[model samples]
Target: MTDLQQNYAHVYNNSVGFGRYPCLILIDFAQAYFDPDCPLYAEVDSALASALRLRKTAQTANIPIVLTKMTYDVAGVTGGRFFEKAKPLEAFLPGRATGEFAKGLVPQPTEIVVEKQYPSAFFGTSLASTLICLGCDSVLLTGLTTSGCVRASCVDAMSHGFRTIVVADACGDRHDAPHQANLFDMKAKYADVVSEAAALEHLATLVTRG
Candidate 1:
């Protein structure tokens, strides 16, 4: 292992187990992040495919699913400082097609859809309370741009007292460097990083227990 990896291995690296009840959080799987023609596109087909598989499993297991989309007012008023810093967020301006959820991955009618103008879904939304109401003790996260929205959501999920699990293969970023680095950092600190297959297996166990 590299020196930095070894350092983290000796101290910060430790796994967090799933809690009794878990909810799935799909963060920002919007068209802007998936459309090749869009500047925000991240080439996340593998992650998207894994997330689809995880979504199917979650649905079958009756897990609570929360889908988050980033949206801003027509005037970009709600995004605040973040909007000013990242003008590219304008892609999600009200009524913009880029703000819509990707086709085939849209939330089901039964799923909860939380719209926010920030990176963390819980920042200005009802996500935490909703998860509590659903009796979710843990969050299984699958989403786009691991270095940004996914990382932000994972940290906030943990801060909200939920066991946070970042489905590694189901989370993507525009580049591998940030993706891998943030995954490592999150695994070492904020959340547990697991694969889509592992998440599915855990969901199966939950079903068997019930």
Candidate 2:
């Protein structure tokens, strides 16, 4: 009930709610965010753990999971202004160790891996079409840097006409201010911001495909 929360209370309170067919999207949980040597490190291990647990749940439920990572060509021209502004993106250069998925999280051959040079996975990528093909009416989003990639994907998921839910526990940022701020904004506008427990409950109610 802070003044800020009160100001936007009733107007922004509608919930998109979890949809019948959902897809889990793990955004940019790469080595760059986990490595101490990398400037992009966010010290968000708990978020990763939560996401892994959610991933396990999704696996058991036979839910489709999609992972996205940053990838750029040799010249790094693909990333354009974003690459120029955030030099840390160089860590994602081809063949770099930082470009790989973080330890303990590996994509199975059956899973889809979308590589991109931008914050929103749907931008310049096939993610939206893929989700449509899968008949995904909703998206379960989890990833590092709540203020960055997670926020971007959440917005895009909504714009793509999918009911989006951002798992709060499974998402984090380098600082709590931006993390909490963006969560508040996203909840009020673009997506459903939910806890890990609530997300799990939603998953349990889903009917898995054969």
Candidate 3:
């Protein structure tokens, strides 16, 4: 297994670095993932902390920010097949407190809030268009469940012609194995999995230029 991973890196060793315009996309940092009583509780407080730090940097740099939350119609019809496949999604049903952003991660009024019913934020939403309209050439993605919505959004962001940068420290999952594996996979193919310090340094450049 180790040998194959090394071989794949040689095969897919290409990097799409940060672009001139970047938007920080915070995906599904919902209270459900932080609440102990919820099935989706990830117990990844540190990842949430890293995301908050990045959010502050993005704001200071005047970068566009987009926050996404999973939501479904009261009857769950909006979630479609994904909802049926993942029963834990009930936590995101309308008016449920678990659907709200986690304590330290609230969207400012000027930031965009995209309510998505599917795993990929761009699947049935205006995310791609919104980013394009904002003149964004890159996506700085962070959020819960690195192997799930974060991975999905990374791929979709790339497909939509944006360079996707996944902040490694800012993405959490139910367990470390999936989180690490998914981060490896994304860095190899879809997105650039980068550290919080690296992301902050990049944002610092933007601030200096302005």
Candidate 4:
């Protein structure tokens, strides 16, 4: 193991296995993150592809899906401090195509879509209550900007008493450094970080027994 890995090995290395009922939460997989011309673009095409596959698997298993998108009023009235700090958030203002959910992975009519003005979907949103209402014991997270929204959502999910699982290959950042670093930190401190393949395998088991 690398020296850094060895150092953290003794500290934050606990796995929270999947629970009886798990829901998939896709955080901010909006067009802005995929559009090459957008400043918020994160080179997340691979992540989006993996998320599409994961979504199909979850749908077949009859698992609940929750999607989140960053949205704000034209004048940024609701976004407040977060909007001020991150000027790039302007891309999500009303009428901006960047704020819309990516085409292929749009939430179905029965699925939940929580529009928020902040990073964590749980913050100022009904996500926690909605998860409870759905009887979800765990959350499988997939989305963009690993160091930002994805990390925040994972931490909030864990805080809400859900076994948070971050699909490593299904989440991306503009650069590898933050993406990898956040994944390592999340795996150690906040949530279980698993590959998309592993998550799909677990979901398949659910489908088989049901």
TM-scores of all predicted structures: 0.97, 0.97, 0.97, 0.98
lDDT by residue (89-156, candidate 2, tens digit) is 99999989999998988998878999989999899999999989998899999997799899999999
Residue runs of model 1 more than 4 Å from their true location after superposition: none
Which segments of candidate 3 are over 4 A away from where they belong? none
lDDT of 4: 0.91
How would you encode candidate 1's per-residue C-alpha lDDT over 100-150 as one tens digit per residue?
988788678999999998999899899999989888999999898899999
The residue ranges of model 2 lying beyond 4 angstroms of the native Cα positions read 207-210
Error of 2 at 74 (Å): 1.8
- Per-residue CA lDDT of candidate 3, range 93-137, in tens? 989999999998867988999999998889899999988988999
Best by TM-score: 4
TM-score of 4: 0.98
Superposed on all Cα atoms, model 3 deviates from the true structure by an RMSD in Å of: 1.2
Tell me the tens digit of each residue's lDDT in model 4 across 17-43. Answer: 988889998889999988888999878
